[model samples]
Target: MSSTISRSLAGRKARRRRSRVHSLAIDGNDCMRQDNIVVEIPTSTARAATMTSSSDPIPSLGQHVDFRQRFEEEINTFATSLVHREPKYVPSHQEDALAMARIDSSCETAIDHWMLAQSFGCVKATDLTEGAIELCQLLVGVDGCEETRKVLETLSAHESVSPKNFLRGLCAGAITRWVYLDTKPQLPSVCQYPQSDVLRSVLAATPNIYRRLVDAMTLEYLERHFATTIPALSKELTKRLHTILTNFRGLKSANTLTDLSDHINNFRVWERYMADAFEGALRLRLNHLRSPMKYNYTFPSSGQPFVEDKMISLYSEASRRRPHQVWLCLSPLIESWNESMDSSSHVIISPARVISS
Candidate 1:
């Protein structure tokens, strides 16, 4: 079976970026889990207090409830163009209802979502660092919005929504329920059984940083550089791998030029030993399958600022020293492939292409 991943550099383009979060370390997939914290909203004692007195000034009497159709007509006429995201739904005749609406169930939530959406600060499709804070606010807002937020918070808490995407893979409805659908994973080339497809989806949604960290933990990066080799893979494992590769193919970063260089350099080395070991192990372990192979890669002595081998080794060394980053063991499945007739046979780990902004 062919396992070559395509790396097309013909259409390269540059984008602008400003960096934050100094020195990012792969904090393992599970570290970012947002579980174990309970956000409680205080009960509405204000309403109870207001109506507590039996000696209320006014006599108890029924108030007129207006007809819906007539009232809606007035409200529509009085509506402003600014209502596109107008804070609340206002009905003119029921000034009382409009007044009540003004008092946000979770005034904080509406404002937070609005600010992020307006400022464009909270629209990250891949990373959830900014979005999670916004999500937490909306999920535990007060008043009528309380119930809805409570429900989502319960689910998020139960699912253990991680600031990291590692736990996200464990959730079944992340793309549909949490993130936008455009970022969902798919079979880049072919379809598979429902159960297998589900597994692929989970892996696809998972954060690669954590995935690599997991591998580093289990495989212990530097213990053995990836030997030039080949391996055979089961059809089931291949499908799961294909899904991961496809997802990573579109991964983009909001890092600066220098940051991107550092990360890319780290990955370049990661590819060497990690890729080699993964390929070597798979080939040696599953030679019984139909085909296995390895690729011949030669990097220029002074291509860019980053040396591929050195960065890979450095990342491994740092990863091993830290204890929380053990998830590297769950690295992607390696599949051997044929790059070209003249080129040596290669083991394909993924189709990851880092996009910089």
Candidate 2:
């Protein structure tokens, strides 16, 4: 009975020793016993082990996907808000038409001033008369009439018509006759697409893109519509001058002969000027295409009634008469075209400058 009690006491002592060792391992002490080996761990390492065991697990694949989706949703919402913002303002058709009219008027006025200042000023009536007399001497030689000389002398002395006015009138008349009567230009058929509300909205939203589009369109239109007819017109004018020179004596006055010489001289300067002017006008016209508007010019025919709104009388007498027919159109009327919800619309920007009978 004593031996049995002693064995029971030993078993209890061994069990208690194992319990104490398990408790010490869980506490992560600086020194521990495992299988009778002493293991030493730093306080920091023990603390890190404890923390690593107790902390939350690493994020899962599903959680990562959810986070990405939320971020993308935020980005999409920002983009949608930007799209709904107020669009940039676009000019109305009427405003564009008026602006273009102003530009055209200003350009023409500048050109006229330049022509007067540069080419016309250099050629005096006396110089023209002398050139005509020389031409007559060359053409008629010994057969030249004394009457022709007297007519030229009289014309040079006549101060009633200023040289500037005379030259300008002559140039205007010749250009009008050539363009409208001799060789009228046939405008090429341009395939124009009307702008939809959506497209306009897009353009209005992005100003840089809109500008680039306009520039490209203008350039393309110019490339296709450049005035090839101008060279032909110039050639025709030269031929006409030659014909006029051949029939010099048939002229009503020696003023005609002097004017012819002035016209020839002016043509040399006008060649480059006309090309530049046409290009500029075409560019201006194309720039307003965003408004879906069309620009055109109307050349008045002879014997057409001279309405005040549609025609400007070059002669003081025609203005005084008030009710006169156009004898000649010095310049064409510029018109703008637009389409309404119901019908088409036409507005004249500038009137034709005319000589009336």
Candidate 3:
């Protein structure tokens, strides 16, 4: 298995080397293009309000109703655009719908997504700071866009005051959700996931400034999350790790960086241990065969027309498994479980089987 993975890695490296020349252009991936980006323009509230309502002296009931409906509709449209950051669908007229259709230029869209989320108070300043830092690094890497260089410089200054951008980048890179996939532990491979791939490349290629920024942001993040939780009184007199990590004073900040790195290493070790333990448990626990629902065992279920239905049923557990089949196949069959009482009610859906079998 190690050999196989190594060979795969080698092949990927070879391919990347071949394409390196072609990829020299800044913003090589269309995904990072920032051209034609649209920002959320704050319009005058008075103009919008006037357009929605009417100035009338004791308006008739029909006019009042029409005005009220139009006003509500306009409000809904504005709210929808702000919330979703996309053009809303209009069901009334095809012409109106066609007119609303806007070409989504990629560069413009990426910036818009990042900026629009920040404008409506959906994202915190810290979060924006983190994003801007990442954008700056990205722009520096691409090295082609003069416009992006200016933006990066501006963001760099802002990042010093607020560690938000740095925080955001650290969170996405470290606290990832793609740990396990389909009841199986995922291999630590950038090629397997887009997020991992980008993160690996960025860290490898970024300047020392960004690297130091990452370390600083991570230390601050650890301080915020863990510093206050540890109790002061302790008989062992070993140390309050969180406090030591957070404190920047002579006694406190001295070993803070090393302490944080140790904590992070410990967490990584724990994650690996847990993954291995789970895999072992899955292989050895045959009692899980009878408790399919508990383990989330799933299998293809029969549907209408017999042949057409390929959906896997969560409620119904497969009675038998092939000799070579792993326990992961017998675990919970559904992607996500519904919380309804009907779905939650436990019944002897699958026949009980011997654990030894």
Candidate 4:
């Protein structure tokens, strides 16, 4: 009888569990279907004991609360921890320190201060140095002061000084002397030989100044000046030519003439003489090399030949005096001159015949 009673109680408990599961499923289904409706889920411990945990089709919306504030607080705490953390150590570079010290110490003088400002502001140190050198050269070339001369002398004396530095000094010295001491209105005097001793000193000190001078030379003004000062130039030209010719006679070698002609041709000062009209002096020098006999015979037969005899050619003797290679290059030019002369003579002779008739 006791066994039967226990069995009845067990059957009752099983029925109750089934009933609770059924009720919970019904509530979950209703909550899922009506999203706007807030289902009151009973928070009783007896009800929780009867319900089994499951992946619900829909969770309770009424019980749901935002975790954004909690997440933001956690993030704030993490950021604050990072902010309060010890800073990393970066060691200073020695080169940077040295460069800053050098810049601070080296910048002196008005020009140096200006250069430093430019270097710090917009320009590089190398660029500033180059620009300063260029400006200094220009200033010296136009008109150098005593201070500039001393600066140049100091720079030139330094074994480590650059070509630009020495050039700046040289240009200043040359220009200063030309403007102040050798103010001859004659172009040849100014261009050819201006205060030779002083000019020589500058050039000797800086052998690289030749190219800069040539590039900067004004050819048009030089040509204009040449036209006005031919008389003064003629005397100088004659003196130099005589010296060259005497040297050529002593050498008795055509190579001497070729070397001299090359020197004269390459000379920037005598560039104006390369024109067809003024090529007489150079041609005459070449002619002497090609036919020394012409000069030798003329000196004894007639008086010392004048510059007017520059074109006087002895075709037979021309080939005899120089080697074939030396005269070969000049053959075409000689032939062209010969043809022109023949045509000119024919025109003259025809006009004379008409008058006679």
Candidate 5:
């Protein structure tokens, strides 16, 4: 019985030692002790075991959920920071004024080229003058009146005022009247708005922004304005043209009553072209400006001394070298002011094209 009890005790002790060895293997120590002997784990075996434990598969969907949560948290934090930030610096009016000074020369050149092309394609000189004269006669209800004859004589006497130039001058005058005089009252009062001061400062700082705003506003205004004025433009222009032709020199007319008139007619093909060109050019000019700027076209009268700074001669370089007077304005000068009422801030975008005598 004693021998059996001693064997059982020895077996229990061996089992405990084996258990300790198994625990050490599970823990993956590089070296372990068993029965006072150091046992080293094989390098390859230890590496494999380490890789096996680390290579446990994580579900792709779980990883995606965790990534999405982190991303959303970051975005929210960024948005909150922006919301709590202070106001950014607003540009000063003086800065805006400087921006306005930097004109777009390319756009100005393009406008000049476009105007020349359109004018070149206009109605023949004789046809346009004849139609204009006929239209003028019909409107005045007389044929070859003293005023008409005198105006024609005056125009003829000026060697530089050719029939073509006469007609062109009328067209130019008509555009000036239509834009500056006739439509002035109807234009929207941009300055009257509550936020106009803020708007002005902002727009001044960025001229391009003002230009875009002006373009959009002008587009909207033109759509409404043209709808009402297009049908009336031809007659209104004819009247104004006749007035310019007859009254530029302050000539008086004898209102002679004529017999029943057989002259009822619409504008001829070239007349229509003239009106369309006028509208297109006017639209282009109106859309070119920045907001809150006041603009006008300079229409120099006949016999005015030519100022080299304001007027460009259609004459050749050799012809322009001589002293001369402005015989007629082929195209009006375009000038603008930074402030609506401030004449001191005047800027000339384009010089007037003229014929010199």
Candidate 6:
């Protein structure tokens, strides 16, 4: 309901066109008919008798027979049904938790906080420790005192932290910095590279890198929120996945966000790149097998939209890359998506893309 693209001019125009093409065609004059009622009455088999005991006179207590017998009969009927019924238990396996679309915590913060984080270069680091430390200092300075002995103490003990460890710890440190700097909580800067609006703009244009960042954030977001319904939650996860990664082209290379003529021409190129990454990732997903998600019977007639941006199928791209693990966890999703029998006879992906049968 609160979609950004959903609220766009193009979206509105499409909706208006749809409304015109599919309006109701009700006949103003209506016809009605009434049918005669045919009822059947059953013949009486026996006259029911209320038995009573004189000493304990069950009917004496109320108006009918003993309540005990009636209760027993009811219990017997319930037991009979129970004996004939199949037992059911909730399925043990559940779909992976998915995140809500666009509700990124960093995005939720006020503009000033984002600006402060940006100005501080919180987003600049490939690894977050240095950025975290600087932000810690800035936060302490903001409080007008440098009781940042806590940060100094904390920073001194990190002699052997890896880059991965650094980002997580850096995120934690940013929280600490925000706590020390102000009376309120703050967004961590580890998510940002180059820690500025400019860097963010650049990253947004680079579809591949931007997607990795979003995927990480999406996991973090999902950890904070899990949903049980498989398909509905899956749909939401799909949407979030798409939003987290974007096709980021260097904006300066182009002119504006709405450089329509260029975008129209280069749009397919964007989609193809994303599709290539996805297909590559699916190839990576070949070996490792986790337990199958209890194959959900209620899969939106398999018509559920793949409304998500998936990451590149890179097996830890780096100097010492583990090519074997690259893209291992992606194929099942793509395979499912590929075979989904949506009524449209087509399964569109990313709007700019489609995987049709």
Which one is best on lDDT? 5
lDDT of 1 by residue, 41-104 (tens): 1234222434323323221122124545454443343233212223232222233223222322
Please give the CA lDDT of all the candidate structures.
0.27, 0.46, 0.29, 0.30, 0.49, 0.28
Model 5: lowest-lDDT 10 consecutive positions: 258-267
What tens-digit string does per-residue lDDT give for candidate 3 at 8-96? 99999978864653343322222111132211112342234333123212332223367545744554443343222121231222331
TM-scores for candidates 1 onward, in order = 0.18, 0.35, 0.17, 0.14, 0.40, 0.19
- Whose lDDT is higher: candidate 3's or candidate 5's? 5
lDDT of 6 by residue, 1-357 (tens): 557766797788977864543331121121111122111111131123232342121111122466556654554443343222122332121211111011112222222232222222112222334433354343223221234444333332333222222222222233222221221212346445233453365365554444444434433333233212222433333332223222111123435655555554444343333333322222222110111211111101011233334322222334253222211111122221212444443322111111111
Cα lDDT tens digits for candidate 4, 238-317 = 33332321211211234466666654543423222212112332223223222212111111001112122222222222
Give candidate 5's whole-model lDDT. 0.49
Winner on lDDT between 4 and 5 is 5
lDDT for 196 in candidate 4 is 47
Candidate with the greatest TM-score versus the true structure: 5
CA RMSD (A), model 1: 39.7
**Please, what are the lDDT tens digits per residue for candidate 2 over residues 165-278?**
333334343443444333323333322424335335535565444444444444444434434344554555544433332322221333467666665565454444543433
Can you give the lDDT of residue 317 in candidate 5?
A: 27
Model 3 residue 106 distance off true place after TM-score fit, in angstroms: 28
lDDT of 5 by residue, 16-77 (tens): 97776765555543543444534435446545653334343232221235654564455444
